[model samples]
Target: MTTALLPPATDADLAVLREQLGRPARGVVGIAARCVCGNPTVVATSPRLPDGTPFPTFYYLTHPAATAAMSVLEADHVMRELADALAEDEDLQAAYLRAHESYLADRAAYGEVPEIEGISAGGMPTRVKCLHALAGHALAAGPGVNPIGDLALARSSWSPRRCVCAQPGAAG
Candidate 1:
């Protein structure tokens, strides 16, 4: 992974992604976010995969701890709470809509896929569907860009500022 926003994916980076995902990573355009140890935390993927599948998730969370944290949040029904917050907060709704647009713009830079047009991951601009997607976007775009994502990350057990990559079977 390079310093550029969306550097070209390298073979070494792909290998780490494969390990994190437990499968070969598809449509990965670049490493979007990295752990303190420089391992990939989130990936920027192509709008359309190599298999011709329409992939809508541009920022895909890959870090084992981060993914697990988001899964735990989802399991705890945090999405419902977040959804309630979004419903009540007009400012949150506006920011989420902007995040949705930002996500769309990021994906559009890769290529166009009619099947996923106007669709951003994690139920943006309306609902909280997947914390993993929202957290991934937050990690990739940084704080404040995605309010829902920021909130999700805040509630999660994981912290991007720390390095859990040294854990057993995890990247370091």
Candidate 2:
């Protein structure tokens, strides 16, 4: 029997992802929701292309089973909503929604699910950073400082990882 090659999760790999997310990294900022399996799960929004298009989105990166089971569209829909909620400006929100719709249309025309890669949040991943950046920019554009922690979802199991590379007080 051939053995399947599974990507190994290592402490170093986690460190790299954490560094990419910046020092005080908020684990995965998930929206509280119920999975198709009826189990509660967190939905983390991944980044889009440079052109501001939402691509293959990952759900709970902590749970491989959920991530593997998520359909592209399902992930996209959740990401769209999360992004919209997190977006500081109307333009960004509109852009995210349009991109999502365009992706759906393209998927229907192609008759296959699109491949969403580089969407995992094993550490503080790039996608999460980008979302954080977007949220930050939006908050900066306004009068009141919309703190990242304010929008952060609080759940019993939701605990931000304290990365080895992280400075003291950086762990969110």
Candidate 3:
């Protein structure tokens, strides 16, 4: 089942996101998750862009601080550790498999692209490729959906419980 439909994004959100990433947003459909400060943390994007290219990444992390936190985890080689955990823990593997399924189901709700039919981001159900993707899934789906995402959230400096909005260079 689709967990929950995200709230429609406001023009304010688009401006903030553009400022956060230092570029314009493409194919954004809704705000998947938001920080305590009311800034969008994760955005749900269209499976296919206006350019007609199939974009597989559905949940996109957009907050500047959250992205920086995930980047720090990636730099620390956390993906390798999570991959190892996935390999050794059957329960974890099962849960991660479920996460993969959920991700795919979520994407399918919008539209399907044959090229990305079975693929899920962050090396899901098999490996931990990108913390940003996993973290996005975690934020959008909330805690307990993705174990790795939970772990990353727990271990990282960033927390949705806290607000890191409007930092030094974040756009208005």
Candidate 4:
């Protein structure tokens, strides 16, 4: 049997990743990225200090769909469309806000809500799930993990690389 070896990290690679991170979200309203399975992952990109070392870090978010979707430009388009829809339709935005507010209220009342972290400013379910998955993956991967780290490693920005939902058509 043969085991696949993981690639080593490099400074040049980190630099390229940082450049990609610098780009602004092109009209992405509510976006999330997650591993197919459902592990919270983070992507970070920062310049190295005088010592020429990268300062990569990762954080937790609550949107698996957005997170996972971000992997592909096509999925990103879906997020963009959702954002445009929200911007154009006040009723839609209001509905999303109401749902999110209700979710938050319920959480506050219950003192615990399952998978509540993924929900962002709007009540986007896939995006929220992706964020939560990313956070969970970051915790499991380690504190040093971040957006840059994930990009450098070519791992999913939202969730663990080996997700159960990581099927070909799993992403939305």
RMSD of each: 2.4, 16.1, 1.2, 14.9
- In order, candidate lDDTs are 0.90, 0.30, 0.87, 0.33
Candidate 2 is scored at a TM of 0.20
lDDT of 4: 0.33
* TM-scores of the models, in the order given: 0.95, 0.20, 0.95, 0.28
**26-144, model 4: which lDDT tens digit per residue?**
21111123344432232321112234443211122333333444445324444454445557766655654544443333223222323334332222422322323333333324433
Per-residue C-alpha lDDT of model 2 across residues 1-172, encoded as one tens digit per residue: 1112213323543443354344422322323223233222232333343454553433223222222223332344533544445465664444444433332332233223345432222112211233322232222222122222113222112222212223342221
Residue 89 Cα positional deviation in candidate 2, in Å, after optimal superposition: 2.0
Per-residue lDDT of 52-93 in model 3, one digit per residue for the tens? 989888999998888899999999998888899899999999
Local lDDT at 84 for model 4: 56
Separate clash counts for every candidate: 0, 1, 0, 40
Q: Could you tell me the lDDT of residue 73 within candidate 2?
A: 24
Q: Which is superior by lDDT, 2 or 4?
A: 4
The lowest-lDDT stretch of 10 consecutive residues in candidate 3 is 163-172
